[model samples]
Target: MRKPVLTIFYQYNPWQSTIGGIQSLINTFIKFAPDTFSIRLVGTGADNGQVVGQWHESELLGRPIQFFPLFTLLDDNVRKLVPTTVRYTAALLSKTLQSDFMHFHRIEPTLAARGWLGDKTLFVHNDIPQQMSSAKGAKTILWQQFPQLYFWLERQLMEQFDQVLSCNSASTKFYQQNYPSMVNRIMDVRNAVDTSCFKPLAPGPYQQAKQQLLDRLRLKPSTRLLLFAGRLHPQKDPLLLLRALAATPPESDIHLLVAGDGDLKSEVEQAIEQHNISSRVTLLGAVPKEEMVTLYQVSDVFVLSSRYEGLPIAMLESLACGTPVVTTDCGQGPSLLTSESGLVVSQREPQSLAQALVTVVDNPQRFTPEACMQAVSPHSAQHVVEPIYNSMLQRWHVSQANS
Candidate 1:
């Protein structure tokens, strides 16, 4: 039998170094997939005019995977402006044509490549339709305006795929009910974490790291640290964290670390000022991947104030590192959270979050490091993700034979 060639499509390239769940998931699949298949990562790259080489190649953990840049400039004349989308149409199509299977990590890129993807697959990182349905304020109004068009697009894009793998249980169920014709094609899998890298630190080192972070921030030794790490988007709801922080008691000895950046960053800053909690927050924008473990180790608890999520990797990473999570009832993250692992707010309100944060912050022993690590141990990448990849490869073979 010939070795299968699989290509994965995502909006951001692995080289971007942006803190995002989809990018992390693509890289994780590449690193953890069995060595039977040759993989290529396809994404839009922005290299303004500093093109060192046409094609970039490297190995992850000594395993090789090729990257085909959909939109990077080859000309030195173009300064820092992103070149036209028209220039990369041919490149994207050619890359898709040459692969045995093309996997998309988001719906936009999949819709962009509609009608021509051979042996196509789509991964649902977040449920867009569900988001629209449950959203408040402007989203509800906009969704109402184009409800028919939105549903039509959802149907049009999903019908052509050979398989659909979802990390969100709610998303899987949503597809199953609306598109009963394709229900057999969808498989639900947990978002994975590599336990080896994300596990907890020893006691002495943990305390040293905690104290160092507190000292660097000029916070007292008795301060309780809370970490909120993810893209500062509406889905992650960075502003909600600020509101929760404000709602905490006036004398609460706690500080929050915001570790990612996005469109909501300016709004987050505004909210912090409006809530009068500027002194209690630190914005650590776009943290390096190497330092993530240390970030989790120093915190008393990990916080997810998202409006919605598919099982966030950062939440899993937090738990794996012995840092319990306090989250809204967003998605799969809450399923893993227990009283011992963490707490989930009854609603997505500032007061609810504040109460939960105070509860966890005041009683650390009730949610110990060991219990947190034990809660997420079963979702290890090797155990949860490798089989999904293997099954995907098998499904690709079956699809091709039938075609």
Candidate 2:
């Protein structure tokens, strides 16, 4: 049988920013997508104004991948407005019309190309309008001032997609309540982890791994390791984690390992200095994805103090590594966590987060590594991807028969 063509549309290049959850999902999809499908990735390359309207061939998952650089044709003004959805849609329409199935990782492109999206699937990673409202500075003011217009436009664009795949229950519920007519189109396809790579180490290997990390960082074995991985941005609220760390007892031998960098790096550093917890924290800025599993294995607990999220991959990765998480109730954290794997604080305040961290660290046995690993089995890459791929193929077949 001839393979169906699957065209994926995303705004940014995963190769360029390999740090985010969205990028990880796109990479995972490309890595594990069935061989029966011919894959093409449509995204923006570096805006060097050199590679626009070009098709570049590469290998992903041992299969051929054709990449279309749509942003090369976009001018600076248009690129600035790319976040608005309409501009990139126009760019993608000409290139994406030939695929058997179209999958979009971002909403703006999906909204722009709605007319040609009869077989398209829109993957909702976050609440769009809410994110806009929560955005910093002038953008937030604009979104707040014209809430109805923004939501109306968003609803119209979302309704056009044949299938809407949400990564969390919170997003599914938001769309169902806001757009009742389109409830049937929404499907919950949660985020997943690679269990094979992130599985817990045996006692001997685990102890050695912990010791190696401690030796490298020059910390004693008795010192507890707390990890915070991801962007050091306002949305991630890295400062809150710093405050919480400062609030922990000064005598406690707790140390924090920060593994990512962003625009908020200077601010985070300033706050670290302000809090006088510099000695207790080390910034191992922007570690590679392969190293993340090792960090998780060595750590006592992973912490995320985000203001909002859809479903963070770091939380899932930590659980898969059999390391418990202590996070604020954000995104799908509340839905994915249980007493066995992690603790979820109700408030985003430093005091609440600190208390939860101290409690989890003090009684590490309460959340067993084996239980943490087991809880994430359902969210393995194989389990999540197979069903979604099958469903997409089935939908494509139905659409073809009707046409």
Candidate 3:
């Protein structure tokens, strides 16, 4: 009768890879607890508005979603006329009005809303400002120039939340240790993987297309493939992967496949060319979500040398596909994954990464689909998320009774 005490956020869309992990969880949560609760999503734009098989706001597993503009003030107005602090305040007020329980997946807007959204759950996915504070030379200087306003704002917001979810233990400790006042509300909810969709590829479209890709490349009969899929950016540290690949033996019978696009696509291409590893490396720009299963099936290992990540969706997909993975120990997730099903290299080290790649490529049998599946089984939507939804509803009921 009380409409199950609504859950909502200004972030989530099935099509946007930036928040794909969060979107997947929301879709699954809806499926697992549809009878008891309903979720409304508010974000920048509508995923269904686009052509070319755009993902519905809540289209996964046949769920429906509602969306609205998240920012109250237009960017143009904020940039040209109003001061940042004032504009940010207006945006926060608008977003707080939009949702009952707010999940701030990114930092900028979350920091802007500091100490405002009373009695709302605030989940900070990462300490982006703190991470940026440690950046090199020019970047570090730029971050320090702001007099740590964003960092202070983030702390203030954390203090205000009724509940906080950290994606990994490291980040959980980050907020707890840094802002001890928030320790009580912090919860550790690692990113969940969509096991049904991402599991081992069936012998259908993915297989057929993969054969065509291999034939087109004139790839040898027994070549091991390494894959990297995500935005092309310095934060991902893709250039490190390039340098690492070039150091390997030219005739190692291994190849690297990069799938996705971003501003640094040109730079990555140039790095591949400069290394003269053109034959061994291929970049497939921005493959759609439906096609990712095929990409994983056609590959041997998935590598992510990111300098930072909360928990990469691609890593989970690759593991689900029965493909092995090699990633740098940049964030908490990689270390948690390394011993169970993949390799974890040190951050920003080309030689260490190259060695790990070679190791995985040589011993493909070391990694199995079952181990990967077991690792991610706990994080599956049905297993971990249903309770969260039920608890949220129960908590809301309790709050009302007390009131």
- The regions of model 3 sitting more than 4 angstroms off are 5-7, 10-33, 46-61, 70-96, 111-119, 127-130, 135-147, 202-209, 216-218, 338-340
The better-scoring model by TM-score among 2 and 3 is 2
Candidate 2: list runs displaced more than 4 Å. 46-52, 61-63, 72-98, 127-146
lDDT of 3 at 219: 88
What lDDT score is found at residue 383 in candidate 3? 64
- The residue pairs found clashing in candidate 1 are none
Model 3 global lDDT (CA atoms, 0 to 1): 0.64
At residue 57, candidate 1 shows an lDDT of 68
Tell me the tens digit of each residue's lDDT in model 3 across 195-221.
777787555865676678788878876
* Per-model CA lDDT versus the true structure: 0.77, 0.78, 0.64
Q: Could you give the candidate ranking by TM-score, starting with the highest?
A: 2, 1, 3
How much is the lDDT of residue 30 in candidate 2? Answer: 83
Give the Cα RMSD of candidate 3: 5.0
Q: What clash count goes with each model?
A: 0, 0, 0
For model 3, give the 10-residue run with minimal summed lDDT.
72-81
Residues 236-293 of candidate 1: C-alpha lDDT, one tens digit per residue: 7878789889999867888999988766778899998898988999999888766778
Q: Give the Cα error of residue 32 in candidate 2, in Å.
A: 1.6
lDDT of candidate 1 at residue 331, scale 0 to 100: 75
